[model samples]
Target: MTSSRQQYIERYAEYAMEQMRRYGIPASITLAQGIIESADGRSPLANSANNHFGVKGTYNGNYVLADDDKPNEKFKKYDNVGQSYEDHSKVLMAQRYQQYVRKLSHDDYKGWAAGIKKGGYASDSNYVSTLVDVIEGAKLQRFDKMVIQQMNAEGKQFGVQSNPLSNNKGTKAKATGMNLPQSSYSMPVQRREFMLITSPYGQREDPINKGKTQIHHGIDIKTNKDNVLATENNGVVVGVDHRTTTGGGKTVTVEYAREDGTKTRVQYMHLSEISVKKGDTVNAGQKLGVSGNTGTRTTGEHLHFGVINVSADNKLQWVNPAAYLAEISQKGNLNIEAQHNGKNILAEYMTAGTKAVNTDEQTPENWMSKLLGSEDAALGIEGGGDKGLLGNLMQMFMTLLMLTIQMENKSKEEKMQAVSDAVINRHIDISSFVPNLKSAVLSINDKGNAVLVVNDGKKEYSHELTNAEKNSISNILQSDSDDTTKRQRIGCIVNAITFSYQASNNYEQIEAQQQSQQQTIQRR
Candidate 1:
């Protein structure tokens, strides 16, 4: 009993070997017994004292310490850590309780699972089940007896070390346990496939944000870009349900077994319709549905692709599919191009390209043929430009040339005939108020001066313009810019009227003063 700890290690060395071969248990169980009983290798009885097992002492009070408990329990202090290991094994093997367990337990995780359950060794109702869970999940059963024997024979040492069971760290080992025999060398990475091309990622605003409450979890797939969806591999449809917010109406979740032997689940959101059911076996390249803007969709059709990864731990992981898709497409907007007039303006690019543009997604060209045709003749003056701005300018120059020819054909008096009945700004319909005004005309001097001619039949009033008026009229006529509005017209007319009225009023006041001065002189 003096070398009790050493004797225990030596005694269980064979039992340890058998358990290791049978259940992939390691040889380090002695280390655990040594550490715990020896109290960090410094217990008095474990050092020079030489009583390692921490056994109890009776009449010999000098070898024992009385631990105060309900009845003051007696604990034997150890002098050597080695003796403690020997005694522990002797106690376990000598006891009748654990004797059957020594031979009955198998190395596979399931046997360990059911065995621990029946043993009543743990307080947890699922104690054995938890071990089995970790064992199966982490592939712990791979440490079977035959595999260990083969590895040992080949001298290919895996994580062959072990520790004693006395350690309270009875939790299941991680997947990185001893690389004994049956373990998977390299686990495959898990993956899943789904179409998420509908909406812009992270652009959930307002209604898609759902009354400022919930967010649009997935994108709305319109009939715009994605006409179909395919499973990346053979898989079962795991889930499908109408979200309070996922689809404008419906959502489908497809799960597949990854090549890495793990599982991946994908979510399809905002579908106009669904074609498959839960538990349906879908293969790669099967059509999920036409992309649609269903629930929570205000605009265009796009698909929202999401990727999910799950571990044997029953936990999930998510990744962004956008970078993946963009990488696959190589920056192409993923739509067909249609050619139009040489200028390649984006017409109906990707169906309803404008209103339905996905957030974060680039825009495609609207190169479709015009569903509504443009105008034909000079649609200004007589009809302006049938061909738009440039055409109108050409038509105006031609009209001016014709008018010059007509003037050359006429005598000087006849040259004035064209102006006696016209208003220069024909669009301003002040006809009923200024009743006698007949027709409008434009009179230009050789000095590049332009005059607006308003002709009444009985009397011809020539309203001449100053340099300021010429500049204002020229500026208004030659304006060519984007984002034009009706307010521009109102402002121009208002400024001209105000300036002219003020100038005329000043001149009339001066004339009135001169008349008053003449009256005062006559009175003097």
Candidate 2:
């Protein structure tokens, strides 16, 4: 699959934030500009040379000539994307733009966006609108909130300590009442207090075969409870089986889909009971079943938590669950608005230099209340009726989901156009389904599986296709193969899904294009 705009945003968000913290440029502006200039790091200029910002200068004496330039203008090249980000920041420090750079607040993205255009950074007249469009479409202004949180933590602005999510206090419940088997291993089980890790993921000496090395796919955590809780979110129970005689006795597998549609399958082995069946949608922290020593190959009672990656080819490869957990820990949960303190920061930066209705009460809380209509609305979620923090989090996530769907639909339209052009020019015969394509919808699930939903005027039919099938369809469309009835149907369905998947945006590239179009309009 092509790199989604969201993927690019995520990839560069940290680097941009780091640069913002160091320099005075707004992180949001930097990110929006990066998306606009680099096509979310997919443009030929960015991919070939790592020149994300189109900064024209020598970086360590390396440069590349522009393909479209009449005089073959040299663009700065960097050894890595990080260097490009660093140079992008340094370029703003140049004398021409130094006045705006010095006067503009780091959080004032709108001012910076307007100022950059006014300072003649780009010759385009619609630079302001292009930048604003990107910033609004992707909600890039959230980075300002992130920076404020960092600043709050570092500066102790409000005497606020660590946020709730960052703190581990009282989160781990004691497994004392469950009467789990006692073991010498006393290391802290991740996200669990009383539970202990008896075995870790990696190559270890095999118990079944003495002196031989074997891969331990997951970490073994001992718990006496009947139901095992999920560690991550968006879990769907995919597989469940009873295997009393095998080493992995009575296993339950749950598949999780990341925001980027990548799938991770987590298996819980040696279960005494299974509560969920296949296809049951489960949430994080939900109980699956009881843990026990039910397998024939087990030495003691423990839950073998294994993580697996489902490849595009439908192959299962085991990965270290501990590593996955650690990576996620650093990212933290963005849904917790209180932790990030988004409301206060967003209000302060968004309306910088504006006078408030009540000058005396112009604090962060007051600003949030003024913007959101009430203190409760700012602290809580509007229209969600006070479901508390978790409820507010869910509401925020729903908004994000809605925005994602809209962006994905636009992306799918673009992808369909590209693929349609390719199919038409190649003389591929999909006439049977081409005229009726409007009634059909295609998408790739987080598991990398293709799903085609077809509406035949009266009834809607949904078919799940494998990666191999999708590839076959792609091959038929691209190759000069003779069209059979089956091949034609397969070609249409697969091509639709292929285009949709390719079109799926994390909203980064589409935002870039929005900015690009603005430049085009200005040039005209």
Candidate 3:
């Protein structure tokens, strides 16, 4: 059987050979580096920006922000994989690598690999060995020989005019421009909380075999056996396997039609249960199976997610699964709207802001009513009237006051713990109040007042803390606690406030309906 790695090499071998003919870089070395660096051309950089070589710096005024040695590092973006291959060649033609380009035979892939690593082309300590392994294992040198033979047949002198910038003084060459394409894709897991990539794709030490490296064809997402695995896109199920004792136990493979009219297959493996079978059409975010550890090959419970590109001739080539998910996530193709019992109320609330009020009364009861958006439903009272609203308000006030007094004499860390406990006891789901809430940070303003900054995966919203609230939070901020701890404490407080407001808003609607019914009874 032709392995996926071989299919990858076969798909891009022509491009590698072309580079060899034009730039004197060995086809074997080019192909080997591409396979390693780009994860066989399925890396996020490769899929999103056609950046197969992981080349950094600007490319024709275009770049993609990705995490590498650091967060949000800028990398060169190419119009196509061919442009990436061409640029990779140009990068190697720099003055530092001129010795390999001019001195070594084009077929000397081993020498080329060692020379490139010596020139600091890659940071990997075993880059040369890995490249040689890939080249020799796949017999990539044959492509180099074919290129040389083709040049001889065409009456062209090999390596004579290979360097396009041989006369240039600089050590590096500038990349030329090309038109780029945009991608809009989706992830297999819609919920961000369960979408953590436990084991990323590409070459890593085999989990089952100690110290032995293997090319992982897919990514493994951290998930429980009860979590329902969802389809990443609109696709038809093409294959299903239910081998519980062997490889990918109970897998479902769905084939999605790309925007460019090509087909791509996504496999959800090690499923505890399969919800869809062969020929079933599934929408994005539609449940496909329950994630599990049914497969003997798995280390624990997780979704073994794999993505493959289907060639026109029906050849399958494995691509990076995380790259596929990231492409869709970056483009906002996944409908990750927050839901509470099947209702999209959180999205509606955040988008519409606070509800409107109609009353002109300025009394204490009315003031609480206005803040809560109802006369009798200020604090979960159905029709308890003013006395009920005041009672609830007093109860809440006393609770907060007592809590504050209790924490006043405690250490800042202890105070934070108490606040966290209070927030947890409320059992508030922050996502129920703010749709796609990413983070919330508490900071002191220039005026020494507390301000809560919130990010809902789109934009930021600032909420100033009341005097009482500020006093409670100020000590925590001034403590030696880490930023993460501070953020968590702040988030707890914010969640409590948000949950209270939402509860009041919900109760206000109930009160309005009750008022309508009472008026009808009175008229009757």
- Best by the TM-score measure: 3
Q: Which stretches of candidate 2 lie over 4 Å from their true place?
A: 1-3, 156-524
lDDT of 1 by residue, 131-245 (tens): 5543344333433444455445756443322222211111111111111122111101111211212233232335544534222233332223243564354658887765536
**Model 3, global lDDT:** 0.59
After superposition, candidate 3 runs with Cα above 4 Å error: 1-77, 80-83, 86-186, 190-194, 331-524
Q: Ten residues in a row with the worst lDDT in model 3? A: 166-175
lDDT of 3 at 443: 41
Please give the ranking of all candidate structures by TM-score, highest first, separated by commas.
Answer: 3, 2, 1
Top-lDDT candidate index: 3
> CA lDDT, every prediction?
0.39, 0.55, 0.59
On a 0 to 1 TM-score scale, where does candidate 1 land against the true structure?
0.27
Q: Per-residue lDDT tens digits of candidate 3, residues 1-524?
A: 14668768856776676577677788899888899888876789988998889999889999999997899999998766777888898889998887655688889888888888888898789888888988888888877887776677767665543322211111111111101124334456545322434455554567887865554677776455544544444579999888898778889888877555567778888898888889988766677888888877887677788777665555554555543443443344343332111122112212123222222222332232222222212222234334422343333432332333342466433443333322212211233223336765444333333355666564556677786775555555566876556546755677676556556667988999999999999999
Off by over 4 Å in 1: 1-199, 208-226, 242-248, 296-302, 326-524
What local lDDT score does residue 211 receive in model 1, on the 0 to 100 scale? 35
